[model samples]
Target: MKQVEIISGGPELLDIVEPLWAKLNEYHKKRSTHFSHKFEQLTFEKRKQNLLKEACDVTINLIVDQTNNAYVGYCICTVNKEKQGEIDSLFIENEYRKYGLGAELINRSITWLENYQAQTIVIGVSEGNEHALDFYQKFGFYKRRYILERE
Candidate 1:
């Protein structure tokens, strides 16, 4: 086990995010939990680039494993100036799952939101992602509303 460090997103960090995005997307697909899997058009690069750009105003935290210089996971949060904050996305590399990385990322996101004076945090997970739902709920997150979708 290596010392894990939490840091803000930076240019040098895209390398980590790009691979993590691919791994996470693959994980979701293999589990048949990717909401857009049917479309088969969600480009990982586009999403990674968008998230990197979005980091300018939003809070994105990465957990890096010092021993191997690998990005174990990341948590993204967006703060509304006057409303609750949003946990945009969170994913831990499958191999790194059980080492408290996900929780640490969530903790950092909450800290960032609190700094912005947000009292509550909101997160939306697709219905098919049972692991995510369970993870968030384990941290005391309750389902606030059902997001309905129509094909």
Candidate 2:
């Protein structure tokens, strides 16, 4: 059995998540029915830049396998000055997904966001990724509305 730990930080740690983020992008690409092209275009650098530009406060929680010295999962939470919170991203390595890593990451992020006095919190799951709806609902994230985008 491997020991696990969670590390916390801000934008300074963004580089560490690139590989994990890329794996997430590939996951979406495979599951997507209509937006694989969008995922294909979403490079980690571009996504990182967007996060840097938009988020006023950021919390990145990384789940590490201490013995293996590996980052098995991560979640990014952001809060703006207006107290709007977002679970910007989350991913766990395929093998690690069965270990409840995703739920742990979300719980940590939600607690952090609440600590910041966030009035409204949100999460955006890609169109073809509705399979995660049940998982997210466990965290009190129910769909309020949907914004359909055109091709």
Candidate 3:
């Protein structure tokens, strides 16, 4: 974890973040008690397209480990036409998890969203990853609502 740096950019960073995003998708798949199949169908390109929708503003921040010149984590932030903000996706490499990278990622991203005047910011945590609830709580994100789908 030596020589760590955080870089920020727009949609062009999407391709750069794909591998890390894939790992995050797998994590969600394993932890999702009911939506594993939903994740199975989610590909990087598909997800990118979702983010590219015309109505929202997108920004990404990546944590790079200069020691090996590798990207260890990334956070994606978005704000829609309605000024609704979202910390849409966040992940830190398993090797990088215990070192506070995730917290830094969310903090910087949320600050960016706030600077953009985000009216409301939210993060959608998949079910079964409830272990992260406490982490999100530290950033002042609490469970205000949960939507269940009939399967």
What digit string (tens of lDDT, one per residue) describes model 2 on residues 31-101? Answer: 88888999999999999989988888999999899988999889999998788999999998777788778
lDDT of 3 by residue, 47-151 (tens): 999888943789999999999999999999999999999988998888888888899989998899999999999999888899999999999999998899976
Which pairs of residues collide in candidate 2? none
Q: Write down the RMSD of all candidates, one decimal each.
A: 3.0, 1.1, 1.1
Model 3 regions more than 4 Å off: none
Instruction: Please report the TM-score between candidate 1 and the true structure.
Output: 0.78
Full ranking by lDDT: 3, 2, 1
True-structure lDDT of candidate 2: 0.90
Task: Output the worst ten-in-a-row residue range by lDDT, candidate 1.
Answer: 32-41
What's the TM-score of every candidate structure? 0.78, 0.96, 0.96
